[model samples]
Structures are given as structure tokens and as C-alpha cells.
Target chain A: MHSKKVRIITVFAAFTCLLWIFGLGWTVKDYLIGAAHSAYSPPAADESAAQTNELKIIALGDSLTRGTGDIEGKGYVGYVTDQLKKEGLDVSLINLGIKGLTSERLAEQIKEKEIKRQIGQGDIILMTIGGNDLFLGGQTLTNITDDSISKLEEAYLSHLKAILADIRAVNTEATIYLLGLYDPFNEFPEGALTSKTVRGWNSKTMELLAEDSKAVFVPTYDLFQLNVNDYLFTDHFHPNEVGYRLMADRVAALITSGGGPR
Target chain B: MINLVQNEMTKLLGKRRFIIISVIILVLLSMFTYAQARQAETIKERLGTVDWRTELQQKIVDWQNRLSSAGQWREQLQIQIEQSQYYLDHDINPSEPGAPTFIRGFVENSAELFLPLLIMIIAVDLVSSERSMGTIKLLLTRPVSRFHILLSKYIALILSVSLVIFIFGLLSYIISAFMFGNQGWAAPVLTGFKVEGGELNISEVRLVSQWQYIIQQFGLAWFISLVVGTLSFMLSILMRSSAAGMGTMLACLIAGAILSNMVSSWTSAKYLFMVNLGLMNYVSGTAPPIEGMTLGFSLAVLAAWMLGSLVVSFAVFMRKDIY
Candidate 1:
């Protein structure tokens, strides 16, 4: 019986050994010979096939949209989703927010095939950009001047216009919520100057969004203007959890009050 | 020679090591399948949709968000982001939903460390145990030459190595198929992605069926296991205590795993057998532990190690003084 069992096992092992050797040889041949398999070409984008009943929220922009400063890591976007869920709405969210993303980068990012497809499927598109472009990581404060600020504004406006156009190209029905920047430096020594610059920036943005009927300019300046220090995070630039809550409450209110695509 | 090998096979089967190895694989596969299922569930719950493209996009964005704080890993993350973007652009799901996909991933991950350790469990004591048990006297007294006896044992070791891999593949397939379902065998998988100078080079990228990719992956994995088995075989001949042999092989494997992560600056370390054991990485297009380690280069290095160990094992076993 032992001999019979060993014989069977040996044959099985021998067969597997040969199999692996063939697999090994085939690998070498395939990798080295450079087989000319045709390159994969993706199918054309079918925009209408992805329709669903769930409220798909696609969040795009910088660290603010990414919940960078909020201790719970739920930025305004998270809170907005939470509130909507509380209202008994089925929601799915895709946050494509990269930290320190400028308007230019966001413009380029939205042009990706997957991002475009995601935007086409979204019911609500939330964005927070121009922070890095305007603040330049707090570098603009050192060289605060009308010429520099306007130069930054000119570049930003063009990029923002391009971004809005690109987004509209793929998704015309999704209501875009462009959150206006809050002046984090409102409590600084140059508080008055920074606040004036930020207000100017926000007004310019609002003017651009005015052209799009579905686009809503959510004002966050007033929210942070009063309790600037209390709302600011440790970096004194981004908003804390409570500050994010304040912003979320405003957006959630707009979204619930017929701001969303019904 | 055939009878000698059959004799070794009887002894090997008598040890029931294959049964132990299969049990180990079964236990590990169950844990992995459960973990994978849970992960898919969490992703579904969070996304509220089962669209793979959206999930992949979210992963890319999450990686991008970490780029700022990922001081040392920025370049690696960048490459990964670009590779993922390439997959998204080509509309090829990097991981399709099925047992084959699970097997592909499992094989790639285990090829480097886990599979090799399993090979060692069978090989580490193949000859050392004979010495420890004083069976060398009876075995050597046979009319067969010392070279034939050793060669038969080596052949048996090779056969067992192949069998262990087969068992591993079979058990993982059965368990994961039950968990993930049997599908995606014909799914298109993108391969031949090349990383150079911290950039993803897609010029050589092409599509192969998932089954073909898995076969090629298993081939490379088999080569890796064989190489590891040969080294352990050499140690078995060189050492008297199986425990010491196992310990030495285990330490080397763990060191290889660690060194592959941080040995980018140590270029000379690329020649080491442990470092070259990640043969699957070259096929899957992950950046090598050291720069300039190509598929051909790794294959050559591994083959050289295997041949060198074979030469050492045969020479030592044939002429070494027996107590």
C-alpha cells in the first residue's frame, strides 16, 4: 500500500514539476520576445448609461474640500453629506480633493477621463479652489501689493473660467457649489488689508459664477469674519471642526432648500 | 535511480509534511478571503455604488492628498498614481472581481516571502534530519553510489517543491472561489508597465487575458520557490541540525523582505539571492529594490545562485566525512 501510494504521489509531483517548468519557460519567452499584442483602446464615454437614483456628490478642489484641518477629518463636504443623510436622502460622495491644489491643477485634474465620467454622473458638484493660488502658502502676505494680487487674480479668473467651462462641458445639470474663501488672516496685524484683498477675490469669483444658472456662490467670508481666531485651525489658515461645521450648515441648508438638483 | 527516488518519496510522504503545508495554506487563505470580503463591503458601504472606476479614482485622490506629508514616499506614490491613472485611462480594471483576480493578487504577494518560507519548511531538514536521526549509516551502506543517493533526494525535493506550490494554488483557488465566486478568467489585464527615473513608462504596456497573466505569474513564482528550495537544500547538506538550518534560512528571508524596502541606495545588495527573490515584481512592474534590476538581470542573478548552490550541495554531500 505504501509503495502504491508513493508511486501515485511521485507521478503527481513529476507532472506538476513539468508544468511549472513549462510555465517558467513560457514566461521567459513571452517577456523576452516582446509579443505584439494590440494595445488596449478604451471605449467611447457613454454619458447616459451611468444614471442612478442615488444622489452622487462629486467634491473637487484643494485641502479644504479634503477636510485637512478638521480634527474629525470631515470637512464641510462631510458635514454636508451627514446633514443630507439625516434628511433621509440616499447619497454617495467621491472626494477628489488634493492638498495644496491650485485652480490650475484642479482645472487639469477635472479633464481626466475618469474625473469627467464622475462629474457626468454627479448630481451635485462641490468645489473649493483658488486658496493656494491667492495665498501662495502665505507667501503673498510678505509681498502684499495691488499689482501682485491682481496678477494672481487675473491668472486665477482665467483658470476658474476654464474649469467651469470644462465641468459644464461634461455635466450641465449638476448644481455647482463654489465655496467663497474665508479670510483666515482676519485677526492678523494686516487684518484689514488681507480682508479687503480676500473680499475682492470673493466678489470676482461670485461674478464669474453669476453667469451659470446652476452654480451657487456659497459665502463663507462672513462666517469666519466675526470669530476668525475661534474658527481657525492651529495653522491659522485652515478651518477647525467647528468652523467646518459652520460652513457645512450653510451649504447643507442651501442643498436642502432646493439648491440641489431634484 | 527510479527506485531510489521512490524510496525518498515514501519517506517524504511518511513524514506527512505535505498535509501540514496544505493545512497551513488553507488556514491562511480563509483569513485572506474574509479580509478581502470585508474590505469590499466597507468600500461598497462608503461609496454607495459598486463602480470600480470611482473607487480607483478615490484611491488616487487619497494618495495625492498624502503626497504633501509623504516626505520619503512621494516619488513612489507619484509612480503609483500615474500607473493607476494609466489603468483608468485604458479602462482596464487593475483588479477585476473574481477568484482569478484574488489568486493573481495572492500569488504576487506571496511569491516574495510566504511561498518561499513554505518551500523551506519541506527542504530545510531533507538531509539534516537523516544525519540527526543516524539514518545516514544505513542509507550510505546501500549499493547505490553517494551521488545517486543525494541526487535522488534532490529530485524528491524538487518534486515536493512543485507539489507544495500546486497544493497552495489549489487550496487558495478553492477557498477564494467559494468566497469571491469563479469569474473573470477571461478579463483583460494590463501588463508590461515599466518604471524608470521615478516615472511610469507605459510604452511597453499591453493587454493580456487574466488567465495568461496568472499563468506567467505562477511561473515566476515557481522559479522563486525553486531557487529558495535549492538554497535550503544546500543548507540541509551543510548543517547537522534541522532547527539551525531553518533558523538560518528564516533569518535570511526576513532580512531580504526588510532590505528590499530600504536597499535602494545599496546597489551592490541587488546581487544577493534574497533581494532577487521578488521575481514577480519585475513582471508586475513594481520598482525594483535597487535601480537597474531588470527582468533579465533578476533572472540571471537567481539562476546563478541556484546553480552555485546545486554545485556546493552535490560536492559537499558526495565527499563530506560521515560520522
Candidate 2:
């Protein structure tokens, strides 16, 4: 029995040895020559047929959209989804918000194939952009000149226009809630100037979104206008949980009351 | 020669090492499969859909978010993001959901350290155990020359390494298939993503079927395991105590794992056998642990080491005085 077992094992081992040698030889040949293996033509996009009965919410843009300052890590997007779920609405969210993103970057990001596909599948879209473009990570705070502010706003408005056009090209039906910028520096000594700049920035953005009938400019200026310090995180740039909750409450109220395809 | 190898095989079978190795593989594979299932569950719960494209997109975004804070890993993460975006553009699921995909990932991850350690379990004591039990004397006393005896033992070790790899593949397939199902053998896999100067160069990128990719991966894995086994065989010949041989090999392997993570600045360390063991990285298009390391370079280094160890093993075993 021992001899027979050894014979069986030896034969099995020898067979595997041959198999591995073949595999090894194939690897060497493939790596060295890399002969034109038939190029694979990808299958056509299947129109994303798996649309379930849930409200698909796609959140896009910068750190604010990413919930950078919220201790709970749920930015306004998360709060919006949670509130919708609380009201017996089924919602699925894909937050594609990266920190420090600018309007120009968002214009580039929405052109990506997968991002376009995702936007095409959403029922609602929430976005926060232009913060990095306008603030320049607080650099513009010290150099608050009219020339620099208009220069930033001019480039930003063009990028925002292109971004909205790209989103509408793929997904015309989704209600786009473009959250306007608020003055995070409302408590600073130059609070009046910064608030004026922020308000101008918001109006220009609101004007651009007004071209698209389905787009709504959700004002966040008033939310931070009164108690800027209370809503600001320690870094004094992004919103805390309470601030995000306030933002969520406004968007969630709009989403719940708006009449659209379920 | 065949009879000598058969004799060695019989001794190996009697030792019941294969049973132990199988048990170890089974336990590890079960844990991996469970963890994989839990991850899939979480992704589904988070996304509310099983669509792989959405998941891939989310992963890319997450990696991008991490790039700002990734410090030294920024370049690697950037390359990975580009590769992932390439897959997303081509509409090819990089990791198709099935047993074959599981095996491909498992083999790639284990080829560097885990599989080699398994090979060590058999190899570190191959000759040392015989010396410890005083069977070497009886073996040398045979009509067979010492060269033939050692050659037979080395051949047996090769056979055993091949068998262990086969068992690993088979067991992982069965276990993961039970959980993920046995599909996706024909899924398209993108390869040949070359990274030069921290930039992803896609000039030679091509798509191969998933089965071909898995086979090539296992091929590289087998070569890595064989190199590790050869070194252990040398240690088994050089050391008097099997425990000492095992301890030395374990330290070298763990050191290699840690070194590969931090050795980019120490470029010369790439010549070491431990650092070159991640041959799968070249095939998977991951940046090598050090610059200038390629498939050809790693293969040559490993082959040279295996040859050097074989020569040393034979020279020591041939002339050593037996007690």
C-alpha cells in the first residue's frame, strides 16, 4: 500500500512538474516577445440596465462635497441621503468628491467615461466647486484685489459652464443642486470685503445655473452669514457637522418636495 | 536514477508533510474566502448595486482622495489610478467576480512570501532531518554514489514543490468556488502597463483572457517557489539543525517583505534574492520595489542564485565528513 501510494504521488508530482514547466515557458515567451496577442475590442456599453427602484444620488466636487470638516465624515451629501432614507425614500449615493478640487478639475473629471456613466444613471446630482479656485487655499484672503477676484471668477465661470454642459449632455433629467459658496472668513477683520466677494461669486454661479431650467442654485451664504464661527471647523475653512446638517436640511427639503420621476 | 528518486519520494510520503501542508493551505484559504465575502457584502451594501464599474469608479475616487496624503505612495497610487481608469475606459472588469478572479489575486499576493514559506516547510529539513536521525550514513553507505543520492533528493524536492503549488491552486479553487462560483475564466484582463519614470506608459498595453493571465501568474509563482526551495535546500545541506535552517529562512523572508516596502532609495538592494522575488509585480505592471528591476533582470538574478546555491549544496554534501 505504501509503495502504491508513493507511485501515485510520484506520478501526480511529475505531471504537475510538466504543467508548471509549460506555464513557465509560456510566461517567458509572453514577457520577452509580447507577440501581438489579439487586441480585445471591449463590448459595447450595456446602457446600465440594472437601474433599481432606489433614488440614485451622485455627489461631485471638492472638500466641501467630501465632508472635510465634519467629525462624523458625512458631508451635506450624506445628510441629504440619510434624511431621504428617514422619510421612507430609498436612496443610493456615490460621492465622487475629492479634497482640494477646483472647477477646472471638476470640468475635467466629469468627462471621464465612468463618471459620465454614473451621472447618466443618477436621479439627483449635488455638487460644490469653485471654493479652491476662489480661495486658493486662503491665499486670496491676503491679496483680495478686484483684478484677482474677477480673474478667478472669469476662469471659474467658464469652467462651471463647461461642467454643467457636460453633465447635461449625459444626464439631462437629474435635478442638479449646485451649492453656492459661503464666506468661511465672515468673522475675520476683512469680513465685509470677503462677504461681498463671496456674494458676488454666488450670484455669478446662480446666473450660470439659471440657464438650465432643471438646475437650482442652493444658497449657503445666508447659512454661514450670521454665525460663521459657529458653523466653521477649527481650520476655519470647512463646515462642521452642524453646518453640514443645515446644508443637508435645505437640499433634503428641496429633494423631498420636488415633483419628478420616482 | 529513477529508483533513487522513487526511494526519496517514498521517504517523503512516509513523513506525512503533504498532509500538513494541505491542512495549512485549507485553513488559510478558508479565512481568505470569508474575508473576501465580507468585503463584497460591504461594497454591495454601500453602493446598493453589484455593478463593477461603479465600484471601480468609487475606488479610483477614493485613491485620488488618498493621493494628497499618501506621501511616498503617491506615485504608486497614481499609476494604479491610471491603470484602473484604463480598465474602466475599455469596459473590462479588472477583477471579474468569480473563483478564477479569486485565484488570480490569491496567487499574485502569495507568490512573493506565503507560497515560498510553504515551500520552506518541506525544504528546510529535507537533508537536515536525515542527518539528525543518522539516516545519511545509511544512505551514503549504499551502492549509489553521493552525487546520485543528492541529485535524487534535489529532484524529489523539485517534484514536491510542483505538487505543493498544484495543491495550493486546487484547494483555493475549490474553496473560493464554493463561495464565489466557478465562472469568469474568459474575462478580459489588461496587461503590459509599463511604468517609466513614475509615469504610466500604455504603448504596449494589451488584453489577454483571464485564464491565460492566471496561468502566466502561476508560472511566475512556481518559479519563485522553486528559487526559494533551492535556497532552503542549500541551508538544509549547510546546517546541522533543521530548526536553525528554518529560523534563518524565516528571518530572510520577513526581512525581504519589509525591505521591499522601504528599499526604493537603496537601489543596490534590488540585487538581493529576497527583493527580486516579487516577479509578479512586473507582470501586473506594479512599479518594481526598486527602479531598473524588470522581468528579465529578476529572472536572471533568481536563476543565478539558484545555480549558485545548487553548486554550494553539492560541494558541501560531497566532501563533508559524516559522524
**Highest lDDT, which number?**
2
Q: Can you tell me the CAPRI class of model 1?
A: medium
lDDT of 1 by residue, A1-262 (tens): 3799789989999999998888888888878778787856776645455566778899999999999889999899999999999999889999989999999999899899999988988899999999999999999987799999999999999999999999999989999999999899877889899999999999999999999999999999999989788998899999999999999999999998986647
Where does candidate 1 chain A have its weakest 10-residue lDDT segment? A43-52
State iRMS for model 1: 1.6
**List of clashing residue pairs for candidate 1:** none
lDDT of 1 by residue, B47-141 (tens): 88788988999999999998888986888888889889988987878999999999999999999899999999899999999999999899999
DockQ of 1: 0.74
- The runs of at least 3 residues in candidate 1 whose Cα sits more than 4 Å from the true structure, single-residue gaps closed, are A43-51
lDDT of 2 by residue, A95-179 (tens): 9999999999999999998899999999999999999999998899998999999999999999999999999999889999999
Residue A159 Cα positional deviation in candidate 1, in Å, after optimal superposition = 0.8
lDDT of 2 by residue, B1-323 (tens): 99899999999888888899999999999999999999999999999888999999999999999999999999999999999999999998999999999999999999999999999999999999999999999999999889999999999999999999999999999999999999999988888888788889898888888999888888889999999999999999999999999999999999999999999999999889999999898888998899878899999999999999999999999999989
TM-score of each model, in listed order: 0.98, 0.99
